[model samples]
Target: MRSTSRTEAFPAHTPAAAQIFTTVLSHGPLTRSEIAGRTRLSAAAVTKAVRPLIEAGYLVEDADDDARQPSLGRPANPVQVDGGRALFIGVKVTGDELIAVLTDLCCRIRVARHLPLTSRDPGAVLASITALVQELLTEADGFGVAVHGLGIAVSGDVDRAAGVVRYSPFLEWSDVPLAELASLATGLPVTVDNDVRALTVAEQWFGAGVGLSDFAVVTVGAGIGCGLVVHGHVVSGAHGVAGEIGHVAIDPAGPPCHCGNRGCVEAIAADSAIVGRIREVTGIEVADTAEAVDLAHAGNPGAREVYARAGDAIGRGIATVANLLGPERVIISGEGLAAYDLFAEQIREAFAAAAFGSAARCDLQTRPLPFEEWARGAAATAIQSFIRSDTY
Candidate 1:
């Protein structure tokens, strides 16, 4: 376990407190007046909520000379999250390994650990997580702070409210009580979330999607995942699944997806599909996505064609999102961006061809966020839960 200075709990545990904290978090180092203004909360309410926060150390008052303003009653100082007051652990469970990190309240990484997994069973995965959390907790010990929460991110259909991994194709898991088990093992509050959604929360607050009211984070890699933020909130469908663009059928006769659907974008454009199709078309016996990317870069006709088809599929999928939501931007991301050079043009062209008139105007930008960012996303979810629970 990592060590840190044990700080007091957040003073305001109410919903209003959470709201005020988040407002300061996203747009912090702002005076209480500024906080009330941005959150649209009355100054009285902000004052009531912030006093305890300052006392608890979850929020701090900045004493910088230049930032001081006399007219603001100079009565209030700018408040920001005390990144060092408490610690949190975030673990991203992948098919092959668990990536864990210890983060401060501001979600900055202090330590990172990667441990390979030999089994995909719930019990086995939990064991790995428990061990990792213990190690991080020990590390937190040195810093003299208590680890406040834990966040785990998994792929597939997850019931966040239930804290269960309802379905995770990558891990071959279903109905796994991951949150309860992790919390039991670590003796800390646990927050479970869909990997993509967790990543979306991070983006909403700290990454490329920041400051955008409506945007989509479309990931292309093992699976084609899309996270939609509508009017500044991530939409989790009633059934706990939303933005499953991978299952979006783009070609009815193109390829078969594991979801038992034909012509799904994932079936046609996912990394596995691209690699497998390249082998069928070129008879080159490609081993993995890297080999396939190399073949395409080497100017092999079949490999290039394979990427073209995947790009076309992605474009159509993106167009569908634009048509449905009318978002202001679509941010393309994920490991598949490594092959973007081979398919960028195709993705753009196909998106243009498929988009409806007005929908086509939304900004289309691509960014490559690594797994570390995804792990940071897990931290974001914990922070969200910590703050949103009171108000929501």
Candidate 2:
């Protein structure tokens, strides 16, 4: 395999250089003119940015014999990010486990490690993260690349710029300076972001939302989450809590949420919510989400009803995003799709009914991603950070 594990500091320090590189990363193999057009930078600026990148071997000029369009004497070669230029480590910290991945400059996973987090307290979780990073660093050594950065993704409000996890209900954390601690332990630059937003970064760069100017990624599982990408940029918002559709209230008297709201989408659609509601209705003493799903699949009306209501709430929440942003598409994802057959119709129905006018035309599609994929998303954030892309 081509190894990107040996890269040191990036070749260009200019913000415009990073911007041009990111444009190529997303829409690559373009002529210099195409890069300039996509990034809104002058031809001279694009040339200046691409020069050092290509020389440093971080970007490669392909042998495309056609599509020549440049005033420079060069054959208008297509430039692209060399995927194997550097390695990054991304760890997605959930309530019960730490999922980690090692990826190259293109955010392609080279290795993955899963470690169960016995405790959610910051102290204990940090230890687990350290161990996981050590394991991956050993793996990276074999690839002959130096890992440059680490990205840790958690749920709730995260100040990415400050590298602070302000709130994470699942972990019962507040004001945790996670990035600084992780950097100290792992000896790398660190980034902390909301898990869903991290996944949206991956989607923006490599998945369903590529080439899209506007899109919403709604995640359903232990918690309800949404990542909004508008104008080819992920909306982290000013307070770093822009696309929080999980808290969108659908009913005044339905269920209570950890956010202290009634009938919020998360309160209804989250896995715990469904399990709790099913146990309340079925009285079957279900132990976990798996058992609750099994009961629903076993033709239990009460269990099925819980999923239906959850679906309806999620649908309404997605509709709120559609009505507000009018994105080109709404991607329904996360582990919740495991029960999609039970409530997919309800979600579709509720979204269609709640969406207003032209907003209804927005496409709703399902993309199933396991927890490992979420870890890959975290790695993608690290790549974005290392490249200094403003969009990430």
Candidate 3:
């Protein structure tokens, strides 16, 4: 694999420069005045910050016939990130598969690959990740741009700052120094983050949460997860475990959770929980979420009830998040959205019933993000790290 032994420093040295560059990346081609307005920076500051980025070929100006001429006392040329200037690699690790993507500086995915996992062991998963990165790196060679960094997203208690997987329930891992391992294997700087938080970064930069300073992302699937962007920053709690809506215990007398709790949101709504519940309630062998969804769609009342319960659990989880942080919007995504028809009403009703006074007004919308997007979210983190000089 082609690797850069030397770190490629981003030209934006100051926070203001990074902020301005990110503004253009997310909402460009935009005029300098627009960047200034969005970033709340002065026009002069935007110009000063943008110059270095443009000189480094990370930002480019476009000609507009209608643009005001600088000689006329105004600069009206719009600027945008040069997507082809740099490349990045992202990998999202799940219990059964790994999803990887190659993205440019703008976080636009150029290639995507999925590989099933034969084993959940750290070494095996790391090998798979390395192979995938090598494939994407070869693809990057075609574009002739160095792959600046790699970001790996995993579910559960990931300590991003320490680059450790404190615990991942699905993979049965704990305190695995994943970033260092991957960096050594691929010879590329790596950023490790929680899967949902990684996806939240993508949303903040290019998806639903764009232009919003406060929002939340709630994902329901193999595990229930939440990501919060409060005051324009992704909230990683003091213990690196914020927005963990999944483990919130809602019922003391209900289903037992793997976390040694009863009726936790994840225990009730996660895919495995729903599937197990369906089997126990209906006395049928449902192999996976797809099969369970089919049974529910085929008018199996028991199966439908299982999904309804799952939905209620999810809705209550969302309401709890809203009542606490009071985000302006809550985006519901993940693989579990496939069965939305089975549980949509329950989710809405439960949320409405549980949400407190003004919290009920928070907008809740469903966006079905494919697995590939989660991988791209991983890529977004790499882009963020590259720009902010946080690479491993």
Clashes of 3: 0
Q: On a 0 to 100 scale, what is the lDDT of residue 15 in model 2? A: 84
Q: Assess every candidate by TM-score.
A: 0.94, 0.94, 0.97
lDDT of 3 by residue, 260-335 (tens): 9899999999999999999999999999999999999999999999999999999999999999999999999999
**Candidate 3, residue 249: CA error in Å?**
0.9
lDDT of 2 at 304: 93
> What lDDT score is found at residue 62 in candidate 1?
74
List candidate 2 stretches off by more than 4 Å: 1-8, 64-74, 389-392
Better of 2 and 3 by lDDT: 3
| lDDT (CA) per prediction | 0.85, 0.87, 0.93
- On lDDT, the leading prediction is 3
Q: Candidate 1 on 1-392: residue-level lDDT in tens?
A: 33322233456668778878877777787887888777788888888898888887888887774656754453566789888987888898889889998988888889889999999988999999999989988888888877778889898998889898999988999899888888777777789999889999888887778778899999999999988999878988897788999999887887888889899999999899999999999999999999999999999999999999899999999999999998899999999999998888998998899899999998999989888788888878877776655111
Candidate 3 deviation (Cα RMSD): 1.4
